[model samples]
Target: MGWTDGYIAVDWGTTNRRAYLIDGAGHCIDEFEDGMGILSVPDGGFPNAVSEIRQRLGDRPLLLAGMIGSNRGWHEAPYVPCPADIDDLVKGLVRAGDHEAIVPGVSFIGDGRADVMRGEEVQLLGAAAAGLLEPEALVCHPGTHNKWALLRQGRIHDFRTVMTGELFSLLKGHSILADLLQGEVEPNDTFKEAVRHSIAQQALPADLFAVRARVLLGQARKEDAASWTSGLLIGCDVHIGLARSSDPQVHVMGRPELTRLYATAIKEAGREAIELDGEQCFLAGIHEIARRIDG
Candidate 1:
C-alpha cells in the first residue's frame, strides 16, 4: 500500500494519545503524545485531534488502539465477544474519516456477566507478538483498572477486571492515606515496607484509616510512604486475583520497574513472574489488527 511514504501507529489511552510515524518496516520516524485522550477531548474532537497528528506527517494512513474506539471516542465500536476469533477483531474495528482506523476492544460475556476493555486488548496482542503471552497464558495488566485475561490460540477465552489502580488513586488523594503524609514529599521506604506487610498479612481491605495506623504505630514511615501504600493496594489486588484463579504463571504488564517489583512479590508468594513492555505491546496490537484486517 506504500512505497514512498510511512504508516502511522497510535496508542490512544484514556488520558494520553500517542502517535508514531513509522517506515514500512515499522521503525518510528517521528512520534507525538499529548493529553488528547478520549476523556480529554470533546465530542467530534477525534477527527480534529487525529487531523492534527496526520497533518504532521502529510495525511498518512493511521492505525490506532486504545480508547479511540471506546464509547467516549469518535465512534463507539462494540466489544467483540470473548473466545473471540481474529475475524471478530477485524469486524469490530472502527474507521475514522477515511484513512485512520481504530482497534476494537474485547468483551467477556458469559454467565450473565459482561466486562469490556478498550486499549488493553491491543496491548495483549502486542504481548503475544513480543513472545511474553501465549494462547493459554494468564496475563495481568496493572493500570487504572487492572485486567486479567485467559487467552487460548490467540483468542481471548475469558477475563476479569479490577479497579485496583483507580481505588489506590482515590484512597491516596481523598482518604486517610492522604492525611498521613499531608505535608510530606515522598516516602520511598514507607511504600516498600507497606508492600511487605501487605503481602505478609495476605490481604488488605479498603481501610484507609488502617493504612494510617500502620504508619503512625511505627510499622511504616513517612518518607516514600506512597510506595508502601501503593504496594499494599497492588498486593491486595494480586492476592485477590490469585485466589480467584488457578493459573500457575503470572505475567505483569505496565511500567518495567513496577512490574519488576510485582515480579519480586510474586516470587515471594511462590509463583513465577514475567514482564512485558506496556507501550511496545500496545504497538504490536495495532500491527496485529492491521495483519488481520489487511490480510
Candidate 2:
C-alpha cells in the first residue's frame, strides 16, 4: 500500500475537514484543515465545496473519505461488508468522475446486530495494509463514537461501536450532572478508580448518578466529576470491548491525549495498551487507497 505518486486526500467529517497534497516523493507537500464539514455546506453546495477544497490543496485527483461519502455527503458510498481489505475499499469507491471519487464506509452485521463506520475504515484497513497491525489484532479507535474492530488475517473481520464520547458530551452539556462535571479530565487516580468501578460493575447508567451524588454528599470533589464520568463510560466501553475476545493487547489509534486516556482505562482493566497516532494511520490508509487507484 506504499504510494509515491501525488494526490489529494480529504478526510471530511461532521465538524471539520482536512486535505493533504502528496507529491511524487511520498511527502505531504501541502495540507490544510477547516470547518467545511458536511454540516457546514449549504444545500446543493457540495460542488462548490469540492472546488474550494481543491483550490486549497491542488488539482490532483480528488479522493474524499469520512462523512463526505455518507448519505448526507456529496454521494452515498455504500458500506462494504466486514472481513474487508484495501481492495474491498477500492472496489467500493464511488466515483463522481474520472479520478474524482469518495471512499465508502464499512458495515458489519451478525449476532442479530448491525454496525457501520465511515472515516475509520481507512485507518483500520490502512493500519493493516501498512503492516502496522497484526493478523489477530483488536484495534480501538476512540472518538465521538468509539470503534473497536477485530482484525483477522489483516482484514477487518468484525467491529462494534460505543457511544462513550457522545455520552460524556451529553452529560457535560445537557445532563443533570452537567455543572458538576466541568473539571478537566486528567488521567489521575480519580479517573482510574472510576474506570475500575465501571469495568467491575459494568452498569454505567447506575454509575453516572454517583458523579452527582458523591459531590452532593461531600464524599467526592465536584472538580473530579469530569474524570470520573469519563472513566465510567470508557471503563464500560473497555469492559464490553474486551468481552468480545481475549485479545490481551488493545491497539488504540487516536490523538495522543485521547489515546493516552483510553490507554490508561485499558491498562486499568488489566490489558495492554498500544497507542498509534490517528493522523498517521489515516494518511497510511489514504496512501494505500491512492496506490490502488493511481497505480
Candidate 3:
C-alpha cells in the first residue's frame, strides 16, 4: 500500500536534478544526482536524459516535479490555483511521456500580483503529509527566490516571493559590494547585528551602501562584508515575510546552511522557527500525491 511502490521521484530544477527510487515500503532504495538540469538539456534532450537514468535504474514510472514541468521543461503542466491540497495536485498531473507524469505547479493571485511555484508545492504537500506543517503556519523556503507560503488546514492559502538570494548574488558578484565581499567570512555577531538593524530599520536600499562605507571607514573588515550582506538581505526577507503574516511560528525548508540563517533571523524577529529537510519534504510530497492517486 506504499505510495511509491513502483515509481521513481524526480526533482528537476534549473541547475541540478535528483532522482529517488522508492520501493513498495516507501523506503528510498536508491538515489541519483546529476547536472542534467533544464538548462543543461538541449533541444528535445529530455527523453535522452530520462533514458540515461532509466537505463541504470530500470524503467519504473516517473513522477516529475519542479522546472521539469515548466515551459522550459519536457512538458508544460499548467499551475493549479491556491487553496490546493495534495488531492488537487494529483488531479492536475499531466502526462509528459510514456509512464511519466508531471506535477502541476501552484499559482496565487493576491496583493495585486500573480505568483507561481513549481516544485515547492510538492515540498509543501510533503511537509503537510509528514505532520511537519501546522494547521495554520507560515512556511519559508529559502533559495534564489525565497518563498513564504501561508498554510491553512493543510492547504496552501497564499504565498509571496522575495528575491533576497538572487539580489545577494548580484551584489556580491557584480555590484559595488563585490570588491568588499570577494571572500567568505564566517557568520558572527556582526552578521546577527546586521540582521537586527535591517529588520528594525526596514530600509534596505538606504542601508546597502553601508557595506562599503563600513569597510572604507575601517568599521568593518572587507572579508566580513559577505556575512554582513547575507544577514541584511536574509533579515529583510524574513522581516517582510513575518510582517505579512500574523502566524507566530515559521517553518523553514531548505538546505541546512540556508535554513540556519533563516532560523536565526526568525528568532531575531521573536518568532519560533522549525527547520525541515527540503529533500525529505519533496520526496514525501511525491509519495503523498501518488498515494492519493492510487487510492
lDDT of each: 0.72, 0.88, 0.87
lDDT of 3 by residue, 69-104 (tens): 999999999999999899999999998765788999
Per-residue lDDT for 7 in model 1?
A: 73
Error of 3 at 6 (Å): 2.1
TM-score top scorer: 2
Question: What tens digits encode model 1's per-residue C-alpha lDDT throughout 157-249?
Answer: 888888877876787678767765444322254545555677678657743457677677886556546666676776676776666457678
By summed lDDT, the worst window of 10 consecutive residues in model 2 runs over: 1-10
List CA RMSD, all candidates: 3.0, 2.0, 1.8
Q: Write the per-residue lDDT of candidate 2 for residues 9-123, one digit (tens) a residue.
A: 9999998999998876556788999998899999999989988877887677888999999888898999999979899999999987676789999999999989999999999
> TM-score, each model?
0.87, 0.97, 0.95
lDDT of 2 at 274: 95
Order the candidate numbers by lDDT, best to worst. 2, 3, 1
1 or 2, greater by TM-score: 2
Clashing pairs in 2: none
Off by over 4 Å in 2: 1-5
**Clash number by candidate, in order:** 9, 0, 0
